[model samples]
Target: MSSTAQTADTTVTIVDGRVVTPDGVIDGRVEIGGDRITAVGDSDAETDTVIDANGQLVLPGLVDIHGDDIESHLYPRSGARMDTEMALAAADRANVAAGITTKFHAISFELDESADRSPELAATLTDAITDATDLLVDHRLHARCEVTQKRCVEAVIDVIDNDNTDLVSVMSHVPGKGQFRDIEAFRQYYENANDRTAAEAEEMIDERGSMSMATLRERVDRVVDRAHEAGVVTASHDDENPREVEQLADSGVDIAEYPITLETAQRATEIGMTTAMGAPNLVRGESQWGNLSTAAGIDAGVIDTLVADYHPPSLLAGVFVDTEEPLHERVKRATANPADAVGLSDRGRIKAGKRADLIVVDPDPTPTVTAAVVAGQPVYHADTTIEVSR
Candidate 1:
């Protein structure tokens, strides 16, 4: 992402919550000076504002590496479009309400002019998200490049050059590879997403399968190299095997976004790349698509981050699930790990001198965000009656 501009005279103190840290959760308070946390301990120092957290869970702001639910925001229904500015703002509110303070909006480039995802639409979405900064959260762009869509390479270059893209991941949804190994699943996805008949979907799948892997690899390498040159992070989407994982890591991929199998995730981690799994899979207790279970990967200690995937609530909910690690470690996977993978080291942890992006959640059996402080500003509070003394 980008650096948050430091401010002045915006000091705040949060007290009476279980403050989470790398060491563990502590019954303490935190101090914020301007946009950075000045202390994270038993400090009761006075400030411009004091937030009584009501003995809630004070955690680091969640950092989601990849989430495309905004696609529904931009295109909420079939063949319908909403105002981009309004949609972005609304998406931000939904994410923050779910305790996500940072998001990498996954936008794809499907250059067949399908109207759902195209070069033009991706560019429009980038501009819209960038312009809607009034929203109370940090927004970054993740350019998902479909190398098979060769026509969109120039547009991808355009976005990397002009748009505020934080990460770029290679994706190939061919029926026999990547996320569409099951031809039936692939057919259903194409038919539903593109309104194609079964025969037409099969025909398109066949066409995509017949494409030259060498050509796609060359184009993907170009995009990856270009992004790397720009100091932007790179990830590979839904790799199916260790060999593919090795190749992607060799291609300068810094993270593995949803490797499809246990072996792939393990190998990615072994090769020093952060492995991410969908939070929805962990929340649902299984992978509905018959891929690797997120909880299994976590149990094996192969996964390092959990993304919202499509649902914002899953990020917050996945933390409370029974993991072998403590609450702080679970929060780290959703916060510090993903942020570090995307080169955002400033706002992920609840440490002194870190940016003050934090959330107060009632850590009951069913958790909910009570308040969110972005850059030391209380932008969202669930119960306005609970006053924040100034």
Candidate 2:
């Protein structure tokens, strides 16, 4: 990714683009004075730099509330680990290149089944993210706690108390429920991914799935209460049914992420919780694990945000997929909707007096991000250089 810095006195203007604002799309210019957008529409001042969008769509930089791309960076190959700072620096560039200005790196605090998701690594990464100051994209933490695991809950609570997490999502990944409703499927996943025999996989699943409903509720309430006290947003993952989602809502969960069925998503919306689906589900037109498709959720009007999940590129690519929804609304799924969902009101919409986090998309030429500006600085530019004016 290309990076450039601008002085505080510099004025950057993006001209000749179809700017996607909160109200609708408009043919105009966006002027950035310092780190915030100073004007949207015509500008009469001579600028220090100009990004000629050339009729492309100028959109708000994506606010991805949940993306686990950091895990992939740390463990590119099985049993291989990279330095924490190196991985974070790489993830920052990858996200900014994909038009994600603000990224919440989803780190798992789970029972130590996988080395990458161990609580030890989670704490190390939380500290690394907290210390990093030279990242191009705005990076934050989304602590995902596996509710069935007491150790995981404790790790998440510790992070909340220390003020390290921006968002917390509680989930139960026990076999025969939630994401792995089919016990055999869960067994096969372990056998294939973990090099475990079928019998060993089943034994492990049974051991992990033995938590009682009362214990699960107690854990969820504990995490939510701690998160609320810290003023952090909370979410429930892989909600499977209306009753399950209702329980989460009643317990003060603010968002329902990746509900497994259309009915579950509808219930989440009905109960006034922000609903999110994976952008990969929308881009690929289906879920890998046979969950509810993002398109179906959008059609039902149950999904309020589209997150990067595992694939950062999918966030931008998913917006251009063929859908009946207007372009502006589709854009909101990646931008305004997620920003609002996470209680981030400073960015995610292209307007005056907001953070100048913006991207220029050339839609006809395969949805390329030609330029990305974060905090009023040109952080990334594609190989096809955009025209500049003095």
Candidate 3:
């Protein structure tokens, strides 16, 4: 079955789509040749294939800098490990269906039960990610470094030195700060994982808290240096205040992943940092942890990128958010801005000589994805019929 609506040179053309470019959303057509966008304009040029977007939004494919939805594919219902290849293949299908062409599986080198991103699973997943052949979109590894675990520095350095990590972000998950501020909140995370009882979780949290990453700054420096030496972009995670943001800048961190408060986010942006937020947080209208809203971050010009984070589909959903920002700017936050944040300049925007990564969005009331193209090839076409409104 063809994923495309119509078939024509060896080229593909999408016409009558409200294409979102950096300038603005314009009624235009885009032509693709090989793996790149050949042209985007008012050209009426004939091509081998033509896809009529039917006046729906034609946008650059969502570039997700951090997402771990793939974790579910690994441990479907909790218990033994499945074939890693099978898991990644299934995850990539879901990724393209969500209109995300550039996906960074934020595999953590941390210890956690709820997420399979634990120490034991890191190598297995990293190997699967590196060698997966059935992926429909561009896949990269966003190595989440648990800085407090001094034992894992050599392992992380080895991967970065081998060029396996495309991006690295230093994380400190101590109990008293960032995500686990409240001791009860920390205890609940462990209790819900069902690995430890509340009392056991509390004990573990206290142990980890005493040895926070603040005390391991030297190890953080070493890991950051190794990542930078390998040309992997480094980011700081869960910034809490202006001082932390400033310190991250002084340490040469390329991006600030998620700031806990509005003041922190604003400070990060002020220091010439790329402030990113979760697309899920934006689409859901709030953060799960009751932190600063990504919408508010956007309004204040603090959010430079919106990553898929834990949810893949939220990237596209965030586009239809009712914001005062122009559609083009909002779209860029998910697409071009993230691509650039990760030092990728080849495949974000719709222009001649750029990668043909795009999503045709059905802009009807529901605003679902209709089709997705990656590297000039259609990868996903929605099976549901798009409903028309009166």
Per-residue lDDT of 200 in model 2: 80
lDDT score at residue 354, model 3, on the 0-100 scale: 92
- Per-residue lDDT tens digits of candidate 2, residues 336-381? 9999888889889998999899999988757778898898988788
Question: Which lDDT tens digits does candidate 1 get at residues 1-390?
Answer: 322344587788888888998789899899999988999988757798888898888999999989998988888875698988877878888999999989899988776544377888888988877666467888889989888777677778778887469899888888888688888898888887678778888888888888897987898789999998888899889999999999888888888988899999999999999999999999999987789999999999999999999899999999988887889999998999998888889978999999899999987768899899987778778966345888
lDDT of 3 by residue, 1-390 (tens): 012222222577888789998899888889887778998987876666677777788999989999988888888876656788888888888888888888899888887654555766886788778876556888889888888776566667777877787888888877877877776777787778656677778777877888845566777788878888788889989888889889878887889988999999999888899999998999889988888899999888889998998789888888779789788988898899999988889978998999889889986676678877787877677734432211
Please, what is the TM-score per model? 0.96, 0.96, 0.93
After superposition, candidate 2 runs with Cα above 4 Å error: 1-7
Per-residue lDDT value at 96 in model 2: 84
Residue 111 deviation, candidate 3, in Å? 2.3
**Which residue window of length 10 is worst by lDDT in model 2?**
1-10
